[model samples]
Target: MIDAANTYEALFVPALFQQWAPMVADAAKIESGDRVLDIACGTGVLAREAARRTGRSDRVAALDPNAGMLAVARSLAPGIDWQDGAAEALPFPDRSFDVVVCQFGLMFFSDRDKAVREMLRVMVPGGRCAVAVWDAIENAPAFAALVGLLDHVAGRPAGDALRAPFALGERQVLATLFKGAGANSINLTTCKGAARFSNMREFVEAELRGWLPVMGVVLPEPQIDRILAEAETILARYVTADGLAFDISAHLATCRRP
Candidate 1:
């Protein structure tokens, strides 16, 4: 069986998450010497980008609750200080970082209000924070189709797992979360991005093998195969000469600590 985190880094990172790393970093306005913290760092795509832009790996720290994800992140970027932790309760001194970023992670936090509060709590008085979350399932036609496919083949749980990432898509919901956490000068922007996979099979497998299990909705191989077969026709509109491609969007929220 393929490791989920490894598959995520291999498939989802380049296809989905990588494009947002620089955008989130830019929203945070990371400078060469700025201390950065990446909450729910996953495979550390944003953390790695922050390290690259900041030009000081020692100044970059990333935290995630998953050991498997952290292990993959550490292997890929050893210079980063990878920690096992959750976003609701950050393991750091108050006002420790100059910039804080959470890319596509706000939706999964058990206590999003607390997590947002923790993000602001760890930043200096004037520190900046940027968070990225999928805009909405309906906004991305490819994923909307995938969700429909999962609902038909894998059941509601599997479809819901795929839908979970877009839970905070609304601009007001995102802005309110940070404001409730006492964040100041909140700014929200809708950033356009795209998801591309080698083919329909790879696109379906990335979610089946890499994402569903993490959400606790693993299907049998036969069911997975069935889904893949259906995906080719269901998601056919996204197929191109190069691969499966479609437009995707996310809301990026930037804020500051008073």
Candidate 2:
């Protein structure tokens, strides 16, 4: 069995999530000697970036509910503290971190408001928190088409699993979430990025093998083949000379603990 976390780090991170780490880290203004926490740190892409900016791995900690993900993160950056936890209930002393960042994680949190509150709860007064979430499904045409294809072929659960990441894409809804969580001086910015895969098949396979299983929606090999075949046609326009490339965007929400 190929570990989903390993696949996520190998395929999804480079294809999509890796580029946003710097943006989220910058949004939080991570500085040397500052303690940082990356909530829902899947494979710790942003957490690694935080460690780089802070200039000390000991000062950076990453937490994720999935132990497999944490295992991969720990292997990649053994110096940083890796914890197994969820966003709604973080396991740390209050005011433990100077900066907190979550890259492309806020949308899937079980209790988004409580998660934000927990993020604020762990930060020192005036500490920075930055979260990155994908923009609406419509903004990313390739994903939008994939969702439709999944809905048609694999059914609603499969499609919804892919769609879940974009649930909190709306700007007003995100701002309101932080406000309800009692975060101060909240700001939201949309950052544009790109998703690059070696080919259309690889793009589709990454989601099929790396993401959907984690969401509890697994398709049989035949269906996977069918989806891949259709995806090549559906997503043809995104193909480039080097590979497949498409525009991807995310909303970065930044705030401070009061």
| TM-scores for all predictions | 0.98, 0.98
Report the lDDT tens digits of candidate 2 across residue range 1-258: 239889989999998998899999889999999999999998899999999999999999999888778889988999999998999999999999999999878888889999999999999999999999999999999999999999999999999999999998899999999999999999999989999999998889989998998787879999999999999899999999999999989999999999
**Cand. 1 Cα-lDDT:** 0.92
- In angstroms, the error of model 1 at 15 is 1.0
Question: Scored by CA lDDT, what does every candidate get?
Answer: 0.92, 0.92
Worst 10 contiguous positions by lDDT, candidate 2:
1-10
- In model 1, where do residues sit more than 4 Å from their true spots? none
Looking at model 2, residue 35 earns an lDDT score of 99
| lDDT per residue as tens, model 1, 1-258 | 238889999999998899999999999999999999999999999999999999999999999988889999999999999999999989999999999999988899999999998998899998999999999888998888989999998899999999999999888999888889899999999989999888888889999999988787889999898998888888999999999999999999999999
